[model samples]
Target chain A: MKLQINNINKSFAGSNNGQSAVEALKNVNLTVAEGEFVCLVGPSGCGKSTLLNIIAGLTAASSGQIDCSGRLGFMFQEPTLFPWLKVKDNIGFGLKILKRSKEKINEVVDYFLELTHLSNFKEAYPHELSGGMKQRVALARTLALKPDILLMDEPFAALDAQTREMLYKELQEIWQFSKKTVIFVTHNVREAVVLGDRVLVFTARPGQIKKEFKINLPRPRDINDIEVTKISNAINQELKTEVAEAVKELEHYEK
Target chain B: MKNKLIRLAKPLTFIACLILLWQILYWLKIWPKWLFPSPADVWLTLVKGFANHTFIWGILISLKRIFIGFGVSIIIGTLLGFLIAKIKLLRETVDPIILGLQTLPSICWLPLALLWFGLNEKAIIFVVLMGTVLSLTISVKGAVLNIPPILINAGKMLGADGLNLYRYILIPAILPSYLTGLKHGWSFAWRSLMSGEMLFISVGLGQLLMFGRELNDMAQVMAVMLVIIVIGVIFDQLIFGKIEKNLRAKWGL
Candidate 1:
């Protein structure tokens, strides 16, 4: 299955009492093929999450079309796991809603439980887990749906630096094994380069895809590797320029 | 050992002093036995009441009314609360009616209930149910309203929507609050049952108090009142208290 997003545009009309019209995205277009891992990287307020929401069909795009022929699963920044559900139950929640056979649901849930290395904590509640562990359960929950397309919005942003790196590596391994189409949103340039086959960078508010860089680096790329750092730096430079231009445009709009 | 005993010291001391004063007042004959029965007289009244099979029947009938009323209240309250939340028109239409019902005292319904049910067990149960259902519904509705939109979205993304949404997501999410509502509802139901017993003249703790009043047996009246207080405290401590403690501990509420 392929995801085709064309000429997507969206804006937020601020409400009364200190509300300003916030143009989040404008004329953004992207695509993801089956088994493709694409990362979106940009500075704050670049509508990275907004774009992901649009893809997941959680937010309606103002003007554009998204044609995807397969199911889509979303992993949010926060784990957003239901506090009332235990870890295994949370992962199996979608199946329970779908009224899937108990046996099949258990099979899929157990597989992911092992895959995410969270089998031991299956009975634990969301509150009992660390930030990283909770996010792992979140990912497992998404994966249990077996969506052809996965849209993740900074799913590991809240974790510590070490945990984030570890999750990134784990995410890459999962992608390699599952070969599912994934669109990951992040602010970390190095993370984008390390995880994504293609990195798309957007300008700040009223976001437009400013540049797309294809990283053909070998698998198991290291952060300290010379080529990886070089690519990261290049992307960072372009991102800085786009951010500066966006800020200038924002200042003009304010006046 | 000392610290543990210290924990019990205040209540023990207060009860001992109260009993001492009661004994002193009785020995001095401050009032007649019928009007101001001593603590020992009340104790004997309770013992004699227990010896009589009528007391047992009264207690059973009263508790039966409470359980019936409480069960109906919980069922209707939970169902209506979910309905009001899911349907806008129902919410608007029923909100004021529930508020009116909640504000009206349980005794105020006695005449109407008696007219409708004809001085039977149903009348007493109706009175108790009226007091409980309103608060339970409001509590459930409030809890439903407090569920964050993000959590609902999370549920939806997991293919949970429609009735499944409420069963899997809304119900569990609102459980703690619903339990709180049930606790409040139980207290209201207990009070309403007591009031109803007084009016309906059933064989219950309330009727026992009334019977003591008719016989001019103040000691028996005080004894029945003590029994009521003890039952209330015991239920609150054993059931609702445990439930609240467990829920708060789990959710860190």
Candidate 2:
């Protein structure tokens, strides 16, 4: 395993003085081989993004063990580009922070700008770009660092359907070329089916791995493909039960 | 260009109306010429002052004091603000005091300044510093605290740590708000300088106004007041305004 997570658990302190602690994650374990793509799918409040945050070291697990030995990149749901920097500069930000040579930074920035088809927008600020374009700049920023692993939390969820579909293809192409291990979190089952080599379905709040499924589909899987739809349907069926259980739990609390 | 002219017309019309009203009041003979000078009388006083170099000299001296005092305040205020913002203990203890000091009027410092520095340029400059430093510090602290956490996280993920984090992320993120602070600080400094100069100095615009008061020349006082207003409006609109507009355009705000 290139990455291993063992017996992970997380709890957040209740906001109010009298409330009980909120359990965010239950005992969980995961492993990924080098260059593998794993998708974590769950309903809302399932702690999928929280898990990704912990792995990226942006958030700490209350108790867990994670063993990995490589640079990591994280892509948030929002583009999170710096408004002050131009697209090329935003993409070059990580390199600048790493203190790369000016020539090297320029070279990498140019390459990714081309890869992301953002050459024309090199001097544009984040606020000038469309949602899709901003996300592309964000992805380029992460790719420029050339991390060994990428942790993406619903990076395309906010984009329009047409933009999302286009980026799905582009993301797959980039992943294949870079061959970085990926841990993706999303609520979209079809997105998981299309993107993941392995998919893990998570139970609702106080999330735990409910089931794991291996995708044996061929390369460049289409989200609308029959095989992908069938697998997505199965995952949705499992997810439906967990969602219903969560609703029942909520009702119990209300009473 | 046409739209710009249209926008300019509105304020110019309002100013013209104001002058016309002043002329009408003068024609009504509401008071003696020395007590209530007409717009023309004020304009004549301004022209005479310019020809004699009194107004020009006063403006130069006042500008010198303002620049020095404002510059020092920026340095001290920003450094202190950053220190307090970064240290939780300092923030909890010092922030409320700073807020309280900010509410005290700039002229309120005049008595203390006179006592401490005794009617010299030092006294006026000290007043200017007192007027602006707290506002600048408070603004810096607010800007620092208001920075979105995600930007910091993104910076860290990009390999920034410690000083690098602040340089790469925090500073740039807080810049827009900080610029606003600087603008506010300048206004406070200008007000403080005028009030301070009125009491302690003999060679600034504020002193010119005081001289007019002593001489019972309402026209000279009004002319000096007009000069002060013009300078304030010019700096606000031309310098700070231009910088803010450019930042907004670049940031697509």
Candidate 3:
């Protein structure tokens, strides 16, 4: 196994609304083989991201152990590029932190930039780039780390539909280049179906793995493909009940 | 290019008109000659002072002390800020005191400074140091507190920890705000230095102002005041303004 997450649990203590504690995740267990692409799909606030954060060690799990085999790279929902840095600098940021040779850093950065097709805009600042381009640069930055496992959280969700569609193709090709293990968290069923080797459907509050689907789809799957759509519909059916459960709880809390 | 020229000409014309109005007021003999010197009299006073190099020496001394005091303030402020920001106990105990002291006028440091360092350059620089350090420290603390947690997380995930994290992320992230604090601290340092110079037997433009007042030479006093204004404008527009504009444009801050 490349990564093994066993019985992870998390609870946020003492909300500002005077609630005693809010359980975010409960007894989540999963394991992934090398080069597997797993998609985590759930309702909003369904602890998909909390699980990713726990796995990446960005957040502390209230209870449970995560045994991971290798280095992990994370991409946030936002590009989160350092505004002052140019595209090249942002891409090379992790390499520089590792104190690699200057030439090695430049070579790795340049390769990633080309991999992400951002070679022309290497001199541009983050603000100067479009949303899609910024996310591409963010992807390049993550890839430059040469991570053994990639943890992405709705990275392309902020982009427009057309850009997101193009990115799906690009991301599939990019994933094929390395075939590294990936844990992608997203709400879009089509997105999960298009990218995931196995799609894990999570339940509402105090989330647990409710269901899993193993995708036997061919390489370079399109969102518009009938097979992808059929799988997405099945996943959507599983998600609706969890989403309704989440909404009902939200309504209760608001009252 | 034309628009830039026009923008520049507008301020120049407004200043010319103001100077002309002052000349008219002097011609009207609204106040006694000793009390209200004409622009020509003030200009001649400025010319003579510069010719003899007295005003030039005063300017140099004042600037030298400021560079020393303000430079030291940046070091102390940034260190203390990091210390306070990292330690919760210090944040609770010392943070409030710094905020309260920042509100207190810088000139208030003069008497205590005098008592501590006696009548000397050290005392004056101490006042300047006191004037600036508190606010600069506050600015740093604010920057630290306001850092988007995502950036820190990104840094750690990227294998930047300990001093490497600060060198790569935290320092650069806080730079724009730190520059802003430095600019504010500079102004306070000037105020504290002036008040200190005036009270002590100091060789500075503030001393020149006091000398002019003692001699009852309104022209010399006006000349010294003009010098202070010119210096203030030079630092504001040419130095701080230029860097701030570039930083904003480059960083999109």
Candidate 4:
């Protein structure tokens, strides 16, 4: 396995205000084989993002063990590119930090810019690009690092449907070529169905893996494909009950 | 294009009305003609002062002092800003002292500056520095703190740590706010330079104002005041406006 998690638990200590401690993740065990594409689908507050943050070492788990030896790259929901940097410079930002020679940084940035089809925008600033284009630049920046594992937290959630679908095709092509281990977290069931080799469904708050679905579909699968829609429906049905349970739990807390 | 015309015309019209009111007050003899000079008197004084080259020389001298004082303030203030922003000990201790000093008007630094430098150019520059540096540092601190946490997290994940984190992310992220701080520092520097020159018997624009008052030349006083206002406007529009426009383009504002 390229990544493994064992009995991970995370909770937030309530402040001086009267609220109690809130559990975010509980007994979350996960493993991913090298070059595998895994999707984590859950409700909004299901702690899927928390899990990714922990794996990225950005956040600490209260009590857990996570073992991922490979270097991890994270892509955020927003592009989050440095506004002052040109497209090429933003892509080369990480390489410069690694103290890579200028030529090497340019070469690596050039490759990713081409891979992400952002070569034409090498001189453009982040603000000059459209939302989708900015996100593409961000993708190139992440990929430029050549991380062994990529952990994405709803990276396309902010895009329009047309743009998001276009990005989905591009991402699948890139993943197929790179074969990097990917753990994608999203609330969209169809998006998960479209992206994942294996889709892991997470429960509501204090989230854990409730079920795992293995997709036996062929590559370049369309979101509108009958098989993709069929699987997405199944996952949607599973998620609906959990979402309702979450609502009921919220109502109970209010009472 | 029409919007730009309207913006310019409106302010010009308002100023014309104010000048008309001032002339009427003079004709009504609210005070002596010397005390309340006619609008024409001030205008002729402004023209004559420019012709005699006193106003021109005064502007050059004042701009020179501000260029040095404000330049040093920006350099030293930005460094202090980084120190206070990055270090917890300095942030907690120096921050409160800075706040206290900022409340003390820029003119209040005159007494200490005169004693320390003994009525020289250094004293005026010292007072000017005190006016803006504290505020600039505070602005920089806020700018550094206002950076989105996600940017920092992404930087670290991309192998940036310690000084690399600041060089690659923190500094670029703070540029817009830093520009705003520079603008604020500029206005403060002007105010301080005026007070310093007025009291210290210096040969700058503020000296023109003082000389006018000493000679009962109300028109020169008003002319110098008008020159100061004009210079402030020119700097704001020429320098700060250009920088802000570029920033807007960069930020997609």
Using TM-score, give the best candidate's number: 3
**DockQ value for model 3:** 0.78
For all candidates, state DockQ relative to the true structure: 0.56, 0.84, 0.78, 0.71
- A1-255 in candidate 4: lDDT tens per residue? 389999999999987878889999999999899999999998888899999999999999999899988888999998988888899999998888888999999999889888888889999989889899989998899998899999999999999999999999999999999999999999999899999999999999989999999998998878899999999999999999889978887898788
Interface RMSD of each: 1.3, 0.8, 0.8, 1.0
Q: What is the TM-score of chain A alone in each candidate?
A: 0.93, 0.97, 0.98, 0.97
Is candidate 2 or 4 superior in DockQ? 2
lDDT of each: 0.87, 0.92, 0.92, 0.92
Best by DockQ: 2
What DockQ would candidate 1 receive versus the native complex?
A: 0.56
Q: lDDT by residue for model 3 over B57-117, one digit each (tens)?
A: 9999999999999999999999998888878999999999999998888888888888998
The worst-scoring run of ten residues by lDDT in candidate 2 chain A lies at: A245-254
Model 4 scores a C-alpha lDDT of 0.92
Query: Can you list the residue pairs that collide in candidate 1?
Result: B58-B203
Residue lDDT tens for model 1, A1-255: 788889999999887867687889999888788899999998778888988888877889888999898988999889999987789899999998888999999999999999999999988888899999999999999999999999888888899988888887888899998899999999988888988999998987878898999999998777667998999999999998877877787788587
Model 1 Cα lDDT, one tens digit per residue, B205-231: 888889888988899889889888887
Chain B TM-score, candidates in order:
0.91, 0.93, 0.96, 0.93
The digit string of per-residue lDDT tens for model 2 on A180-208 reads: 89999998999998999999999989999
lDDT tens digits by residue: candidate 2, B1-253: 9999999999999989999998999999988988999898899999999999999999999999999999999999999888888999999899889999889998898888788888788888888999999999999998998988888888888888899988888889888889899999999999999988887756999999999999999999999999999999888888888898899888887
Off by over 4 Å in 4: A99-103, A252-255, B1-57, B87-93, B115-117
Report, to 2 decimal places, the DockQ of model 2: 0.84
Per-residue lDDT of B237 in model 2: 83
Candidate 3 ranges beyond 4 A from true positions: A16-18, B1-7
